[model samples]
Target: MSASLTLVVLMAVMYGTGVYVMLERSLTRFLIGFVLVGNATNLLILIMSGPSGTAPLVTGTASDDRMVDPVPQVLMLTAIVINFGVTAFILALIYRTWWLAQLGDEGDTLSDEHADDTEAATEAVFNQVDLDDEAIQRVLDESNEHGDDSHTTRKGAGE
Candidate 1:
């Protein structure tokens, strides 16, 4: 097959696959679809760049017609790079979504129980410590020097 025909066929296949993948329910499939479409777009830009020719160097005999169009090449390269970055971002989002899903609904319940246990343990330790007024004032004074606001510290329910 001719080069143009091959490029056209490839682009069509990629585009078709991209559209099909995008219709799936999964985010991972969506990312794949996006990548296929982006690749197709890059191919389209490459096709628009026209046939390869000698370097565009402006010599005494060199004319614009004999020179290759650099604009399309530059545009195609830029588009491919941008598409790559977008694909990476989309992949990251997909990974995050999958990770969160894997955590399951029970994870929240477990985390809540763990938090409760931690709070109870902290309270137990606090009750065992007997800080006199002088010690408390010294801690507050030190906290001020360290740029910490003593008022923002968590207070017990009785306090």
Candidate 2:
């Protein structure tokens, strides 16, 4: 079945922009990219469903060949629902990340205090994971006994 040139080009553009945006380090950009890609996928399904005809509702005058297929329309609705759920999940992630960073209304400004807090939080997580490994913990303990102050451990860690 033939598809519209305009639609194909628009889909291509959407896909390209979505991928580019998703590659960024920002979670908000990733959300926007995911939305763009999801809508483009719905458009793709619509295009593949063949040319539009009469409404899917049965009418005495319209034959089967003149009636539009409803499967793609239903699929698009389902895709929309899935996209909404995923969007909500991503929004929650953004909120949690912001909360963890504990930023104020400063807006995009990472002060030294905030940066150090974030770094310490990250290091704490990594150190906890490392401590769970027995061999790594032994090495850390041995290094500490030898007067090597490089490895920093959190208080009450591995307790």
Backbone clashes in model 2, listed as residue pairs: none
What C-alpha lDDT do the candidate models reach, one value each? 0.76, 0.83
Residue-level lDDT of model 2, residues 1-159, one tens digit each, is 599899999999999999999999999999999999999999899889997887898767638678989999999999999999999999999999986666445432256656766657766766777777978778888877765433334433544
lDDT of 2: 0.83
Compared with the true structure, what per-residue lDDT tens digits does model 1 show for residues 98-149?
6455443533322454666655654555565645656888988887875554
Q: How accurate locally is residue 10 in candidate 2, as Cα lDDT from 0 to 100?
A: 98
Model 1 — TM-score against the truth?
Answer: 0.61
Residue 2 alpha-carbon offset, candidate 1, angstroms: 8.5
Looking at candidate 2, what is the lDDT of residue 140?
81
